[model samples]
Target: MPSAIRFSGVSRHYGNVKAVDGVDMDIAEGEFFAMLGPSGSGKTTSLRLIAGFEQPTAGDIHIFGHVAQGLPPYKRNVNTVFQDYALFPHLNVRDNVAYGLMVAGQAKAERYRSAERALDMVALGGYGDRKPSALSGGQRQRVALARALVNEPKALLLDEPLGALDLKLREQMQEELKSLQRSLGITFIFVTHDQGEALSMADRVAVFNEGRIVQTGTPEDIYYRPEVPFVADFVGSSNVLPPEIMRDIRGVDAYGALRPEAVRRCDAGHDAWVRNVSFLGASTRVSMQVHGVAMTMLLPRGAEIPAVGSTIQVCWQQDDLHVMSR
Candidate 1:
């Protein structure tokens, strides 16, 4: 498949600061791809580069086989949805959604019709008359989506679009956003620090760190087979076992990643001293010291919870232990 967006040796530097440094990526057409990382990791900068909001210091950016670098945002066939929604309080939802078309010299009748169709796509069909202040946060977010979709861009660039919503609302929107992307069959480039949001909504993910992509793969590949320690620790809180621990367990002088949930309670295994037990709704997180190394295990619901300060035997399947390459 052709690429919706491509970056070749892309770098955006500010004096000594390299916000995006020598990054190469190919985002496929009609794919839902996520750039996942913490703040200042260059994920947001990458999105901006794609949207033409920021220019690359040295490299090429191609959007649908056309050179996108140095082009204005309006010239790129892409739309951006920001976290703050950026709605106009004075205008009604219909007018707000049609603002882009209005600016493009579209007539009132045509722009309003396009805006209404976009609003319907976001399930806000009847909210055309509502003002920005009259709607809730989620509704405003949908309005933002409608506004972005009004132009029917080839790709959608989202910069933490669900960041402002509450947990429940965010979860609800995740599903809706994924569904909408599939239905629209357009490239959706989502930038977020939330691992859950990326893993749940994106078809593929690029894990970023220190202005570079550490790993890029499907969610399962990133979670189960992290190539480096940073990815293992950041993506799902996996246990980054030291080389000594791996030597003791696998007779290999290398670091390994073990999922907390992969630690099983066996009658005969390594005895672990429980240090803390945290009840987290569906599961209990137990912090333990194993062979002098502090580790954690997540006990599933309905399982017997061990009291803190107690000792228990824990074991893991060999397959569950992923030996890191670096």
Candidate 2:
């Protein structure tokens, strides 16, 4: 399939700082693509560039087959839903969702009908007359989504659209957004710092840091086979074993990564003791010290919780290990 959005050697710099440096990526048409990273990691800047909110300092950005660098946001054939909603306080939900069409000289009756349909698509039916202040954070976000959807853009650029909601609401919205994307069959470029959101919702994710895309892959590939130390540490909180230990375990001089779930509490292997135990609803997170290195293990809820300070043996299969370069 053709790309919905492509960045060819794109960079956005401000004086000595590079907000987005040399990012080259393709977001396939109708795919749920995520740009994930921590603060100042350039994920948001990349999203802005796609939405035409920010221009590249170098190289080019393409929407579909057209160059979008010089085109203004309204002409880019894409719409953006921001974290803050950006709704007009004076306008009701219907008017807010129809604003884009109205600005484009769409007839009042037609825009209202389209806006209502969009609101229904977002499960905000009958909410047209409600003011932004009357709605909850999640509702406001849905209205924002409805507004973006009403535009019927080829792709949607979402910049932390769920960042403002509570944990439960955020999780709920995640599923809703995924469903919405599937139903619409339009490309979605979602920008978020939340690892859970990216892993759970995106068909493919681009991990960014220091203005560069460090890795891009499916959620499982990125989590299970990180190419770099940063990706291993960031994606799944995987334990990065020391080179000496890795050499001993795998007989190779390289950085090693082991997922918490891959760790097993064995009767004999390496002398270790449980240091901490965290009760996570479905699983227990056990922190242990093995050969002086801290390792985490996620045990099923029904499994015995290792007593803190009690010595135990921890082992993992060689196949479960991911050896990466420095």
Candidate 2 lDDT by residue in tens digits, 1-326: 99888899999999999999999999999999999999999999999998888999998898898999988987888999988999999999999999999999999999999999999898899999999999989999999999998989999999999998999999999999999899889999999988989999999999999999999999998899988878988998999888898877789888888999999877878787789999999999999888678989999878888899998888889899999865
TM-score of 1: 0.96
* Regions more than 4 Å wrong, model 1: none
RMSD of each predicted structure: 1.4, 1.4
> What TM-score does each of the candidates earn?
0.96, 0.96
lDDT of each: 0.93, 0.92
Task: Encode model 1's per-residue lDDT on 1-326: one tens digit a residue.
Answer: 99889989999999999999999999999999999999999999999999898999999999999998879998988999987888998999999999999999999999999999999888999899989999999999999999998898999999999999999999999999999998899999999999999999999999999999999999999999998989999997898899988898899988899999999799999999999999999999999999888889999999999988999999999999999988
Candidate 1 clash pair list: none
The list of candidate 2 runs beyond 4 A from truth reads none
Best by lDDT: 1
